[model samples]
Target: MSDDPKTLVSTDWLANHLKDPDLRVLDASWYLPDAGRDARAEYHAAHVPGARFFDIDEISDARSDLPHMAPPVEKFMSRMRRMGVGDGHQIVVYDGAGLLSAPRVWWLFKLMGHRDVAVLDGGFPKWQAEGRPTEDLAPVVKDRHLTVRYQNQLVRDVTQVSQASKLGTTQIVDARAAARFRGDAPEPREGLRAGHIPGARNVPFNTLLNTDQTMKSPDQLRTVFEGAGVDLSAPVITSCGSGITAAILGLALERIGHDRWSLYDGSWAEWGMFPTVPVATGDA
Candidate 1:
């Protein structure tokens, strides 16, 4: 399979190009509260050589009360500049939990209109397993400019999502676990309601991943979405508990050559908190 820098790159591809001057690797690891894994501490301990730590929580919109909403354009550009990541650089983001949170970072870069970004297939876990070179040292800081042409079409807010739900013209694909989607399990976060957005079809993110945590083939992915009752002809709005795993779904859609998809920035974090929006349980 070809490794597209704009989509997913393998460890082999990364190893061969590790020394490329224009390459920027990011350790964008994150986890839920109960996972008990410290992403920052783990990065400090060991990470891909020349990799910078991209803290999703810290780099997000601090002004938002909800969890890690999209950061403002100015903040995103400033943080990317501070990290020495800028225009003309090919960014490869990988997470500690295989492919968990890295795609979310990839989606964030796409939101900023930087299309030359990709998620590391199998992520840090596969790299470590393959005896790839890693280091604990921080990358050398250099001055770089990241021009922002933020693409609003790649992201949706609560208002847009609600309107789409009511219209039923667009497909809302939820990435949470089936249990969580069905209201059979409690949300990891407190004070949010169970169940999913009204008229949404459930396609749990893990179903799109292989046993090794790498994404499945494009054909396999197409089958997965079709099996989930998602109509490929309709526009898709991907969402999850806090808009993290939702990007995994978005990435899969991209891999399958579906360009008409957007991520819900607030996702269930904003949707579930509001009692005004209706929620549906027990499958779509």
Candidate 2:
């Protein structure tokens, strides 16, 4: 029932507003290399009615060696225009793995300076389980010019992260699971070191969600953060395997009205691969 379009929207809210002319629903499904699920193929098979597929990897910064870095402003504007998503449209992004990948897209939209976007609570699973309408037909296209004003403060680089870790000024929160954060589990990426940045706190993104895969209440979210020993009052920077799931933490932070936050775009993917930066193993 919360009408905060900048954070999240429930399945019921999306279902009720399906027909609104200004509403734009996007299927932003993506999986890690180990998941073995093809997001584009799945989208072609079935999707919410009138929902467009937002390819995370395809619509990204191709120049970077890293995986799915944010696309340039011109590229983002072009992509949105082609998809008929532009100014004044209220966007709702969802993914196949419930709350997994949608928040990344939501964060991307916000990073591009679009605030009228949200992630679908419980995502595609919840909608389908409720027997909501779905279709495979591609939506009719009508190009619309999308304005771009990138929010530089919303993203951080490895250099900035290194400085923060050294200075202990920002609360760096790692979204990787406890095992990964502790270096008890090997990283999925090859030739990368295990463990996390020094002075960082672990807050696995899944801890903030309910059993049904929907995000927990605001009070519950705050509890989860506090339980993880995170200082919510400090400026926060979220990170994950490849900078993807970290956005889930970013979204959770926003849900609780924590605005002074940024996502480390390189995250562990870049951090682990480099030898110049220091790494910490085991729970502190």
For model 1, how does the per-residue alpha-carbon lDDT over 1-284 read when each residue is reduced to its tens digit?
57999999999999999999999999999999899999999999999999999999999999999989989999999999999999999999999989999999999999999999999999999999999998988878897899999898999999999999999999999999999999999998889999999999999999999999999999999999999999998899999999999999999999988989999989988999998999898988
Best by lDDT: 1
lDDT of 2: 0.94
Note the Cα lDDT for every prediction shown: 0.94, 0.94
lDDT of 2 at 150: 92
lDDT of 1 at 93: 97
How many clashes (backbone N, Cα, C below 3 Å) per candidate?
A: 0, 0
Model 1 misplaced regions, further than 4 Å: none
